[model samples]
Target: MKKLAVVNGKIIDVEKGSILQKNLFIEDGKIVEVSEKEPDNSWEILDASDCYVAPGIFDMHVHLRDPGYEYKEDINTGLRAAVEGGVTRVAAMPNTNPVNDNISVTEYMIEKAEALFLAELYPIAAITMGQKGETLTEMGLLAEAGAVGFSDDGLPVENAEVMRRALEYASLFDKPIIAHEEDKNLSGDGVINEGRISTLMGLPGIPSTAEEAMIARDVLLAGYTGGKLHICHVSTKGSVEIIRWAKKRGIPVTAEAAIHHLTLTEEDLYKAGYNTNFKMNPPLRTEEDIDALYKGLADGTIDAIVTDHAPHSKSDKEVEFDKAPFGIIGLQTLLPLSLRLWKENILTLPELFKKLAYNPARILNIPGGSIKVGEPAYITVFNMEKYTFTEGMILSKSKNSPFIGWKLEGKKKFIIVKDKVL
Candidate 1:
């Protein structure tokens, strides 16, 4: 294979929290060297003098509504969106039409990703059959067929006994049960956060207790079963405290926070005139919750940052706030929105990269989140001050994002994954 060299970029060492100017050399899909000296002229060159080079992003939660809902997003389009956002890998949630509860569906996703060969796609199988909250799926079989983890995302596994059994079963395979923690009863008909904002708009609210209550139960169950539990899209301050306590007690638990939750708040909903694009499950929370999330992220209470990139068509998002479906597409907006953390000094550059790249790879037990010799060539290059984001810049099939028209601080320049530059 021909050798590739990336020259003059600021290489971020997330593990060590440092940044240094270095040139990288790659051959046969693995990095061969990273040094201050320029590489030989025989190697092909990719200039990065104006950008920062880091590990390609790995998003642990995404919704690629393929098979059943292509109009929203399919693997082909969704993976492209991921690549466009400098993401080299993503863990797709199993909430498709046939509900990925079996081996066949799991294999299909793997096979499809292999065929496309853009960004790496890891499948997360459904926890229960049909996601009905009744019987558990074939965990062993699903894992054997390439499922990275299990979750019934978009729908919480409400039955306590079922969730307990699922946790126990998943523990046998050393896999995590990605809990979409929420008490449906408490969140019933709620469109946004349960607080002054919801009341002022005369809309029903989804209490923070709904999320914290379920997290409290699952953390206990995970401790009792000794299972690896990963909580998804953590939005409440109370939930963060529970996870910190669980970690302190040495219970195997990890949690993630979405970029939207970190940057925007419930005040954005009113500012947007109750636009559906600002509406999402676990809705944009309050400033207090956002503050706590930042603290959790900084202190290691939150393990990773994810997009939860739920795509919806124009018709799906054009309805009234109460009638429209939850979620806004996020794959393309993750980096720019996340850059706000570094821009505001909430997190240092390396610290932000840890949440975006290293932690997600560790949580999913995947390869390719480091810039080291002999490591796979998964790199993302970006210029922090050169670009701006707009609605027209979205590459996804859907354009339902609150960040549209906002001037973002960073721009992705190149994505190199497994010897291929995209």
Candidate 2:
């Protein structure tokens, strides 16, 4: 086993909320020690001064677009993008062409990722077969084949009876049924959040109620079935309040606030007479909603900060605003944008680390989301400084970014894991 030591770093103790000056020694891909003193001259040393050493980010929501749709994104490029952005592990959504609803597809994704020796990538299988929401997937076997969780992603199962049974069956495996909470009926043909912006922009509106209605139903189903429920890309304040209350009532519910939702608003979509690049689903809400998103993160109403990093081909995004695909490539920009929160004094460095890494690991039952000694040596070294973001430089195959020229703060220096630099 190779041994390497990172020297002179400000380590973020997420569990303790303290920053310690320390050096970390890694052996056999695990952290053997973290000490205030430097290692004796035998091991390879990586400089970490002026960097905040913390656990690598674990993004619970992302679309690698492999198995099919390689033009949009593939396993290798997606993983490389993730590692480059300081994410060591990710749970890739299974809303691909074949959909990860069966054991063969699930195994294929897991095997494909392992063969590449890329970042730690786990697949979240589709909750319903083919993601049609008509028939349920083989949850038990899917979990056995290494599906970390289950989600239909872009399509929410609108039938309450189907969701209830899925929850009951999925609970037997102790895996979370990650729901994309949206009432399709209420959403209709809406492209962005239903509000004054939608009306002014002459676009159909997807009211916040579309999201809340589903979450409200899922919370009760999860409560009734005793299943763990995870709500993805929670953009509305009403949903955050529901999740907070559900947790208080002993419901096994967890929710994530996307990076964009915490930073941008629907007003950015008001670039007059322009084609849309700023549009995204759970469409960016008002500034008031952004504040609520931050509040959710601070008060523990939101359990994690997910990139919701959806990638689409340029041609797919070139169409009209209402017709174009709804998403953005956030994997590479998640940390820096989120760091804007830290630089602004909205959250301490340690607090941000908790939301980005530790807390998600706990809820997902993953072991790599910590900077603790003796754990797997998955860490991100980052620089907290002013910088500008650009699109073509993104490591992903797609270049669809809403924040393409944003002046952002903080950037990742390295993604360290498996006794090697990724």
In order, the Cα lDDT scores of the candidates are 0.90, 0.86
Task: Judging by lDDT against the true structure, name the best candidate.
Answer: 1
Model 2, span 22-114: residue lDDT tens: 988888899888887767778888888898888888888999998889999999999999987889888999988798889998888888888
**lDDT, candidate 1, residue 413?**
87
* Residue 208 error, candidate 1, Å: 0.3
Off by over 4 Å in 1: none
lDDT for each residue of candidate 1 in 1-422, tens digit (9 for 90 to 100):
87889999999888878899999888978999999878778898999988999988988999999768889989999999999898988999999989999999889888998799799899999999999999999999998898989999978999899999999999898789998899999999999999989989988999999999999999999999998899999999999999999999999999999999998999999888879999999899999999999999999999889999999999999988899989988898898888888988889989998889888877777677888887888898998774657778888888889888787778788888878888
Candidate 1 pairs with clashing backbones: none
Q: Count clashes in each candidate, considering only residues at least 3 apart in sequence or on different chains.
A: 0, 0
Clashes of 1: 0
Looking at model 2, residue 335 earns an lDDT score of: 91
